[model samples]
Target: MRSPAAGVPDPTSAALWGLPLWLWVVLGGIGLFGVFQVYYWVGHRLGSRLYASRLGRRLGQDNIRRVENAVRRWGALAVYGCFWVPGLRHTLPWTAGVLRISYPWYVVASALGCLTWVPVTSFGLYSMIWGWLRLAARSPALAAGVAVVVVAAVAVLVLRRRRRRRREAERRPEDTLTTA
Candidate 1:
């Protein structure tokens, strides 16, 4: 069912077993880029740990300063990498100034990283799928296995962080709970 790496077989060329090739290509690109960006942007802008109001004020000034230093020293790669790194992605940019990673550089690196990841993911999918289909005459269980692994990994990360936060909260005295 999957198309080639470009996302779909070229509409102008390949006519296969289903919808017109042109429509699939156009829709596929829009779905991939548009939907992905919106999801990423929403997460970046308002995820609980990272929203400006939360981390910006809660951590006071010192931790923010360390973050600012990290940004300045490493630039956009640091910010872009944060997306996959969970804690940073949600909270870093809000206090990025405290970390001192320049906004301009952060934007450039984040955009490039986001842009490249999509095409690369799509292309890799195409290669894997094409190989699977050609070699097996029908794709096997590999893709399903990959999906399960990715989901399980993400779940483990989310649960681990939540557990750590809960344990830390429990250790704090009733009044000291205000600090983290």
Candidate 2:
């Protein structure tokens, strides 16, 4: 793949002020953290109405209720765990707000979750981008082939994992013992 910038070979080198690209990545992640905090605040303010909206109904009242129960049971830890899950990320914070988790606890949990999530995401992105740039520089065709293979492998693995989980779920009832 060709670099977007004609003259500039390495887009990563493009930076604001004197700071390196990775610093900016970290800052962006922190910014996302702040945005999510505000998102949580909105959920806090909206409370039940937010959950009663069309989108919320789509998310399923039972599901939201389950999340609410999880929040009540686990407190900040539920927020932390759900922060890493893709679909649940947005909902978890809002649920935390509806549960009226302490402001300080929410902040601490958010900070801790972001600390783990942001750095890993930034590093993974940096690595993948650089790896692709290097591969494409050597041979664009090879890079494209490699990208396809990686995506296919990931898809297969996810499908297999889901199938295995479904099988386990199916067997659970039969696996239980019955009293005479």
Candidate 3:
């Protein structure tokens, strides 16, 4: 909102902390891309042993299998799509490396994903936080209510997902036994 001597609006006036919002978004995107590269290399180095590692066990075999299937089916395109999927974003990169998908294609897809996804999420999150702050300034009680509602919604979603996973786990053994 502030302007310099030349009457041009200062970009840093809208910044979070000392850096501009655009700078933060760019850094975040670059950082995420770098992490993806590391995941790919580690998976490539581990090869099949990745599935037996501590991190892999933590991720669970079922999750790995699902990621593997995505990579197998979609190849490089899966890398871009994964950016939009919370769970698959981290897992699919590793699987792609293990499967040895073309590095050049993988780089292109991941870069494109970073370019598109980062700006949208960054601006959206920025708007949400600033809007909440402005609302809080106007009415403390209303802001508190909004916060509580958002938390409750997230909690409900998490609980439902956990219950569904538990039920599926319980049924898996029965399904295997019946087939056998």
Candidate 4:
């Protein structure tokens, strides 16, 4: 992908930033999802490495004990809230597991933290993505093509869902009105 060299006379970047607000929005979402997926994968790997299990070591056990207390006492909201906090997320899950923190609660709290992370940080990210996508808009036809493809795909999905629902309703027409 040998693109225009640095400081080259490229109009792409300018064009992208000049695109309509809506196109930037769509691209921004796509960019945000990509970034989050990368972050999630890295975070998981970092957690496992830093908080690796050792069949039975005192330090490991102590770390687990501390994690368990935090989770057992505060739950996932606490886990997730501290998710982005260095050292906490990595050790918390491992310790919680060892401490026998309820599996469901662990999942719930972690999910909450992930959910919280997005709204808290996505706005800033979306702006950055918008700027990047704006650069892509230098090629008008390419940008329009992308927009059309996305719209067409969404339309196809919606039509498919509606058709499936209609068929299911026809097959079970009697069930639809049986209120007794």
lDDT leader:
3
| Consecutive 10-residue window with the lowest summed lDDT within model 4 | 50-59
Candidate 4 per-residue lDDT over residues 1-180, each given as its tens digit: 224565333323323457854455456545544443443444344543434434223234444556556767786555665567755745555555444545566666665665555444554565555544765667767767777887899999999978976776677655343436
Which window of ten consecutive residues has the lowest lDDT sum in model 2? Answer: 169-178
The 10 consecutive residues of candidate 1 with the worst lDDT sum are 171-180
**TM-score for all predictions?**
0.45, 0.69, 0.84, 0.35
Where does model 3 exceed 4 Å of error? Answer: 2-12, 172-180
lDDT per residue for candidate 1 within 27-109, as digits (tens), equals 55555444434434554455434434543554534455666666666766666665556456545554453344455675666
Report how far off residue 112 is in candidate 1 (Å). 2.1
Count steric clashes of candidate 3: 0
Candidate 4 pairs with clashing backbones: 16-134, 16-135, 17-134, 76-109
Question: Model 1 misses residue 153 by how many Å?
Answer: 5.2
lDDT tens digits, residue span 1-180, model 3: 745574433545668788888999999999999998988888788897987776776566777888889898898899999999998888889888898998999999999999999999988887688779878988999999999999999999999989987777676653222223
Clashing pairs in 2: none
Q: Looking at model 3, report the run of 10 residues with the lowest lDDT sum.
A: 171-180
